[model samples]
Target: MKSVGVIIGSIRDNRVGDKVAHWFFEKSGVKKNLNAEILDLKKFNLPFFNEDVAPMALKGNYSTEEGRHWYNTVKKFDSFVFVTPEYNAGMPASLKNAIDYVYPDWNSKPAVIVSYGFHGGVNSALSLERIITDKSPIKMNLTNTKPKLFLSKDILNEKGQFKNIDQDFEKYTDEIKKSIEELEELLNTATANK
Candidate 1:
């Protein structure tokens, strides 16, 4: 089975990215070919990039202890699904730092970014798309922004737990499902090329 990393891309307290990642993984885990695991960056305490060279040029030998461990964990996956939220119309700094910490680990691999926020975090997804495109490790398998996963007004309650997110979003859910199906084809093509 191929390991699929479900990345929770936000580190803000009460950030719903982790919840969405868990929900997505629970759903994705039912797939017979995918072994989904949540790769939470919050647990890693990685520092901002301070190495002498870019991660791509490091040849995968990360400089810091946290960086090395982060690289290794990311390397274990065949593909990734980034669950992120927009902050100031961009992705969180920590998520960007996490991506900057590695190079070779994501080469030619597929990344499906699932973002949520007012208007579905489309801006953040666009920002992320540009970042990923400029890099060589991972490729965007699907880039469409369907805000079905958008952080709805009542999505979370007073206690900061999910309420509306667990239910289906009708047509939007179908669209999201279709996008995931496209990943199977992407994986096949990637495997063949490799």
Candidate 2:
């Protein structure tokens, strides 16, 4: 089985990214060849990318302890699912910082983006896809099926807590499943070539 990291790309307090990530993990885990785990950015606590040298220059030998730990964990995953939230129509700074902390580990790996926001976070997903695509240094083999998750005020209270995640997100399950299938296909193909 190929290991997949379902990364929660938000680190802010009271963020909804974890709920989204957990749903993705559960959905993806049922696949016969996938071993999925949720990687919460808050738990990693990576500092802002302040290394003197760029991550690409380090070639997997990170300078900071946090960077090294994050890299090692990421290295184990054959593919990834990025569960992100749109902040100001873009991905959160914490997600960007985490991505900046590693290079080769992300290169050539297949990944899917699942973004949640008012308008389903399409802009946020695009922003991340641009960074991880052929145009950028990360160069992850991204899946075309980018799933957009929307939040409705009716389902959220005044303080922004979900009354029922499953009920609110049921509509997006098919897209999420398609994304997993695409990721699995890519992972299988990559493994075959190697």
Candidate 3:
């Protein structure tokens, strides 16, 4: 079995990213071949890029406690699924911050984008793919999850806790399963070549 890090990209107080992430993991977890876990950005609370050097080549110094914690968290996983919310045609700042904090851990890893927002966060997914491609050897999976429907009502109940609609949940689950299968194939190919 392989372990995948499901990164929840949104850090807003009432964000829908968590709901999406949870649904993705719950479905993926049922597959005996996959060991999935959600990596929430809110827990790290990483500060803005304080390192003088860039993370592109993994040359930067991560001296802060938060930076080290973030790095360690990323190192544990073989692949990633970024659950992001579109913000002004791109991923949220918290997701970018988390990615910027580390480098080599993402190399040779496969990543799938699961985004939700108006227009299904397609712009955000594209933007995120661009960023990841430039720095790491990430095999970006095309089978993504973007709820074309409004998430406000389904993801949040009147009391503010998260909720799920069966239909939308099924779509997300199917996409994640497909992405995972693709990722496994990619990882195997990369390994064989190495």
Candidate 4:
């Protein structure tokens, strides 16, 4: 079976991205062909991308220990699911920096973006998609069924933390499942071709 990394793209304290990622991971359920694991950026705590050469030029050799470890962990996965939150209508700087630290590992691999915000986080999702698909040299074979989760006040506490993920995101479960299935299909194709 192929492995899928579900990345929690936000690293802010008390962020809602964690709850969403956990919920998505659970919803992914049992997969016959894929093994899903959560890759929390908060836990990784990667430093800012300040290498003298861009990641693409490094060819998998990273200058920093953290960068090298991150690359090693991510390269094990056959595909990914990035669970992100919209920060001022764009992806978080931490997430972008993390992506910038790795290259070649992401090339031609399948991925899906599951974004959340007050207004569904469509802008952040689009920005992330463009980065993996066009902006960076690392091109990911992204699944078409990217799930945009809408976050309303009812589901969040007064402090902006998620209160009930299953209730708030119940409507989007089908969409999330579709994204995973699409990625599985892509992974299957890649495996067969290899």
Candidate 5:
């Protein structure tokens, strides 16, 4: 079994990311292969990358206590599920900052991105896919479902509460299961090399 962290990547007031992450945390835990936990970035309260040297060059060491805590927390996870919101067609700056603050902690780890928004957050998820897969070097496993809430009146009244309820979610659930299975394989491969 692996320790999986579902990261709540937004820090704004009444944000939907936390709600989404909590939901994912529960869903992931039922999987026998994973020990899922919620990692809220808001709790970390990391300042902008105040380091003189990038974490990538430092071999994942850090100069600040906040940075050290963040790195240590992330290091425990064999896989991740990032619950993010689309901000201006991209992920929140806070999320991007968190990613910038770390390095090898994410290396070779598989990340399943779950983004929700008016347009299903596909654009933000796509942008995030680039960051995790290209820039951060985390494996970007994704769900085809995209998780969109389509009605303006219905959503504004509910205030993103739709995620709190369990829907069919069959497709997304299947994708998540697949991601965990593949991630375990990757983890085994890494261990085998050692």
Candidate 6:
């Protein structure tokens, strides 16, 4: 089975990113083919890019302990699902900061976007794709999830939970499964070549 890192990009207190990621994993039900793990950025507590080096790759000296931890965490996964929140029509700075902390770990891996916010976080997802492609050269899966997450209140139940949202959840779940399957195939091909 292939391992996928489901990265929750929001670092805010009481954020909904984790809940949504968990929901996606549950809905996907692709454990036989893919192993999914949620990687929350808040736990890393990484500082801003403060290294004196002009380029991060040459020095590779992470300024703080959090940076080292974050880099190690990122290196563990072969693929990623960046669950991002739109902030001012783009991804949050914390997510971008986390991405900047690592280099080679992100290269050659596959990535998929699961974004949410007003306008379904489409703008943020697009911007993130550009950044990831430019920096890591990772394959960006066409299958994506862009839930209109602002409707959480309406879709969620009385216990503040969203168990099912009609056919939308099913559709998103199918997309995730397809993306992971493609990623697994790509990973296998890459491994064979090596």
The best candidate by TM-score is: 2
Q: Give me the overall lDDT of model 4.
A: 0.86
Lowest-scoring 10 consecutive residues by lDDT in candidate 4?
27-36
Residue-level lDDT of model 4, residues 122-194, one tens digit each, is 9999889889983456789988898998988888899998777888778887888888889888988988899
**What are the per-residue Cα lDDT tens digits for candidate 2 across 77-183?**
88888989999989999999999888888999999998999899999999999999967878999888999988889878888878888877787788888888899
How accurate locally is residue 86 in candidate 4, as Cα lDDT from 0 to 100? 92
Backbone clashes in candidate 4 total 0
Task: Report the alpha-carbon TM-score of model 1 versus the true structure.
Answer: 0.86
lDDT of 3: 0.72
lDDT of 1 by residue, 1-194 (tens): 66678788888787778877777665543254777677888988888988999887887677789988898888888777888889899989988999988877776677677777877888888788877863424444553433336666666688766775657333355555655665666677778887
Those runs of model 3 whose alpha carbons end farther than 4 Å from true positions after fitting are: 29-31, 56-60, 134-163
- C-alpha positional error of residue 179 in candidate 5 after TM-score superposition, expressed in Å: 3.8
Better of 1 and 3 by TM-score: 1
| Model 5 misplaced regions, further than 4 Å | 28-31, 134-152, 155-160, 167-172, 192-194
Candidate 3, residue 129: lDDT: 80
| Candidate 1 collision pairs | 106-137, 107-137
lDDT of 3 by residue, 1-194 (tens): 67778888988878767777777676754245767677889887888878767776544457788898888888887778888888898888999889878877777677777777756788888788888763435434333432332355555679755555555567566556767777677656666788
* Ten-residue stretch with the least lDDT total in model 3: 141-150
For model 5, residues 34-118, the per-residue Cα lDDT tens digits are: 6877888999999988887878787656888888899888887877777788889999998899888877778777667777787
- Which pairs of residues collide in model 5? none
Q: In model 2, which runs have C-alpha deviations exceeding 4 angstroms? A: 29-32
The C-alpha TM-scores of every prediction are 0.86, 0.95, 0.82, 0.94, 0.81, 0.81
